[model samples]
Target: MMPSDAPPPLPEDLFAAARQARTNAYAPYSRFKVGAAVRTADGRLFAGANMENAAYPQGQCAEANALGAMVSAVGGQRIIEVAVVGGREDDPQDLCTPCGGCRQRLREFGTETLLIHICGPDGRRHTTTLGVLLPLSFGPDNLDIV
Candidate 1:
């Protein structure tokens, strides 16, 4: 058993998945590759790599791709946690975090307390909750739904 005050150990599988996914990223413009993985409440894991487009604004984020995979596999499932890794293709040791849009995208399927594990080439470097990244945010619960 682990102590209540102690932080949970890093999910090694998620880190490996995310790191592997980063190699598949299509980044012709910025040369910045990113990978992201998400674990659903049901324990399902999904990973994805960033894909850049000719038009800068049209690029797809790694987190969005991972979420899409989860939604396709199991619709409407809640995301319990996420891991994101990113860095320049040449040097993948720098730390990275989800963008504002990606954060909102994650919010669609996760709660404010959802944990996001930030990682670098070494491994999981930091951990933070969605609420900390996006404070006082609105979500599906904020509006009417069938």
Candidate 2:
């Protein structure tokens, strides 16, 4: 999670970054290109795209890849704002929200107020907070510390 529970407003370019990353998705099997971008507590932005593998579950979601990029950049910065863009290459769908597993993954580094922006390839978008999306959920604090 972030060093502080309360985070500031989102950056202006987060969605652009996510959409740009979406162009680089590696989804040969599903053709569903998804991209994710997260802003760290310090204001640095990182982006990642979905990658599919022949081994099915071995693939990684764009959210996971974005989180990995955040960690790789400076090691687990709290994700203050998140933007996700996804749609089939041939057709731009209406919804592109994170999957169930990816939602939990986002919880690993986000607090209740973390803002999530869901976007369609057609440029339509929706905004919601993590608290609203994953209410009454489990997280790191649920685990007993040593």
Candidate 3:
């Protein structure tokens, strides 16, 4: 059972969508599978899983994959919410927050959007606004392209 204050339990379909993506993860090195589901402002949901490579630096984060999918599927629509989950056996509690690069990407789309982090079977969730996650983040405003 999930905690009483766990963001009112995301729609079952939403979770299933993320889980399906998790199954496709290609993590032979770390064996740490991660899945991300991103909801766009247009009501489109894009899901992606981590893809690891032998060259550690070449691997893509789950969040980045999801974000890329969202952009590709919806022509760069603004993102609304992002949920990240991970574990050995589809456990959600073991999920960790997005890395610095992912955070910056979130800021580019929606700095004030909600980030939902699910831990495990109990559905333990941590919610935080993207602005809180990336303070003073650089974005379009920072780039001076004349």
Candidate 4:
């Protein structure tokens, strides 16, 4: 069980996870590094970072990589919370939010999941929901085939 006062994985912790993922990233082009951390419903944490390619379209988003890691690690479990960050250095000073495709992916797995975006040295955080991230989102509910 997660500790009651687990402090929601401090900004530094999140940054560490992101940075770790960043290190494993296979970015051969577009040095725009991104990272993601996902918390499983059972409280397991998984992290992933952006992997760019010379082909551009072949690149993978940080969120997608994180989701893949989470799925592979936890089997089938809902994601509770997710944090995404990016920077040239592993500093928690420069971060950004997930892109549109990432948001949609989040909504598909957990529509109500908490998405946190942190930036700056002070670890200023912006909290939002997948619903807000993907307004009028498409999901399993939207697809019907008989």
TM-score of each: 0.88, 0.84, 0.80, 0.74
Candidate 1 lDDT by residue in tens digits, 11-72: 98888888888889999999888999999887889999999999888999999999988888
Query: Could you tell me the lDDT of residue 109 within candidate 2?
Result: 88
Name the runs in model 1 displaced over 4 angstroms. 1-6, 88-93, 144-146
| Reference-based TM-score, model 3 | 0.80
Cα lDDT tens digits, model 4, 82-142, are: 7776653455545476788888778666754454554332443455667666767777557
Query: Tens digits of per-residue lDDT for model 2 on 63-89?
Result: 999999988879976778898988544
**lDDT scores for all predictions?**
0.84, 0.82, 0.71, 0.67
Candidate 2 residue 14 C-alpha distance from true site, Å: 0.5
Best by lDDT: 1
lDDT of 4 at 79: 73
Measured with C-alpha atoms, the lDDT of residue 138 in candidate 3 is 77
Off by over 4 Å in 4: 1-12, 87-95, 120-122, 141-146
Residue 145 shift from truth in candidate 1, angstroms = 3.8
lDDT of 4 at 78: 73
Q: What is the lDDT of residue 123 in candidate 1?
A: 72
Q: State residue 57's C-alpha deviation in candidate 4, in Å.
A: 0.4
Tens-place lDDT digits, model 3, residues 1-146: 22345454565555666677777889999988778888877777889899998989999988889889877776666777777767645544454678888888777777454555554423435666676777777776567531
